[model samples]
Target: IDGEQINLSIWDTAGQEEYDRLRTLSYPGTDVFMFCFSVVKPDSFDNLRDKWLPEIRQHCPEAILMLVGCKNDLRFTLFNKFQNQERKFVTSDEGEYMAAVLGAHGYFEVPSFHHSKVAPIFHEGAREALRRRR
Candidate 1:
C-alpha cells in the first residue's frame, strides 16, 4: 500500500456446521488468517479457541494470524447499556490477552459499521503478509 500494490483475497468462512468441509478448501493459499469474533458475543470468542484456531492450525499452520474483535462500537453503546443488567461485554484487555495466548501477529478492535476503523486492520494485515513473503 505504501507505493506498492498488494492484492489480497480474503475468504470469510461460514461458522455453520454445514460449511466446515468447504471452508478448509480455502486455506491452501492463505497468507494471513483474520480470526474475528464479536466483543458483544462471548460465544463467538469461545468458538475462536474451540473451532477456528484449531482448524486453521491444522490446515494453514504457517499463516499469519490476526485477532480482530468486531463490533467495537457496541462496547460503548449496547455494552454500557447492559453493564448493570447482568450482561458481560468483552474488554480490550481480554481481547489482547487472548490474542497473546493464541500467538496472533496483530490485534485490532474494529467497528464493522465504521469503514475508517476497519481499513487500517486490513492495511496492516497486508503489510504483514508482504513482510512474510520476503
Candidate 2:
C-alpha cells in the first residue's frame, strides 16, 4: 500500500443479524481480518473472545483475525472501566493465540488514536503476511 498497488479486501462485519447471510460469503479467501473495538468501551480480551470471536472463526476459518483495541486517547476509560490496567500498548499475543487455535497465522493491535498510524499498521501487516505466505 505504500508505493505498490495491491488488491486488499477489508470487511467490516455488522453485528446485526441482517448481515448473517452476507457474512458467509466472505468466509473463504479471507487471508487476514481485523476485528476492531473502541478502547473506551467496557470490554476486555476475554470478554471480546467470548462474545464476538466464535462466530468470526466459524465464518472465516482460513482468515487470520487480529483483535485490535483502538482509541489510544482513552487511557482513563480503558483502565477505569475495562480494568485492563496494564494494557498501555498493543500486542499480538492474544491474536496469535487465537490464530493458532483456528489454524490462522496470527494477530496484532493498532491504536486508532490517529488514522495515520493505524492505516499503515493494517496495510503493512497484511502485506507482510502475504509475502510470507508466498
Candidate 3:
C-alpha cells in the first residue's frame, strides 16, 4: 500500500423523481460514486440504467463510478420468481455495459458475502479513491 492519507466525503443521493432536477449538481468533486441498484427490480437492467445513469454522467463526468448490484443474498429468493441465471446475467451485463459507456472505474455485485456484510464494497471503493488521489 502507498503511504498516503485519503479523505472521502460520500454524499448519498436518493433515487427519486423529486430529486431529479438536482442530479446534475449532486456530483462534482466526488472522487468515486456508487451507482447502486437492487437485484429485485422487475425492470430490465438496461431500462433502469437508461433511465438513471445518463444524468449521473452529465453531472459527475470525472468521478470514478462503480455500478453496484445490491441484495446478493436475495438471489435464491428470486430464483423462483424469474429464470434463474438468464435474467441475472442480462442485468449484470447491462450494468457492465453502462459502466463502460459512462467511464466508470469498475462494477461490483455485493450482497452480504461475509456474515451478511458489505465491507468489501467499502474497502474496494476506498482503494479506488486512494489510488486515484495518490
Query: Could you say which candidate leads in lDDT?
Result: 1
lDDT of 1 by residue, 75-109 (tens): 88985677778787788999989889889997799
Stretches of candidate 3 exceeding 4 Å from the true structure? 1-3, 42-44, 81-98, 112-117
Q: Give the TM-score of candidate 3.
A: 0.70
Alpha carbon lDDT at 69, candidate 1? 93
Candidate 1 vs candidate 3: which has greater lDDT? 1
* Candidate 1 vs candidate 2, TM-score winner: 1
Taking every candidate in turn, the Cα RMSD to the unseen true structure, in Å, is 1.2, 4.8, 3.7
- Residue ranges of candidate 1 with Cα displaced over 4 Å: none
lDDT ranking from best candidate downward:
1, 3, 2
Per-candidate clash tally = 0, 0, 0
Measured with C-alpha atoms, the lDDT of residue 128 in candidate 1 is 87
Clashing pairs in 1: none
- Per residue, candidate 2 scores C-alpha lDDT tens digits across 32-66 of 76766654453555445665567766776555666
Q: Output the better candidate (2/3) by lDDT.
A: 3
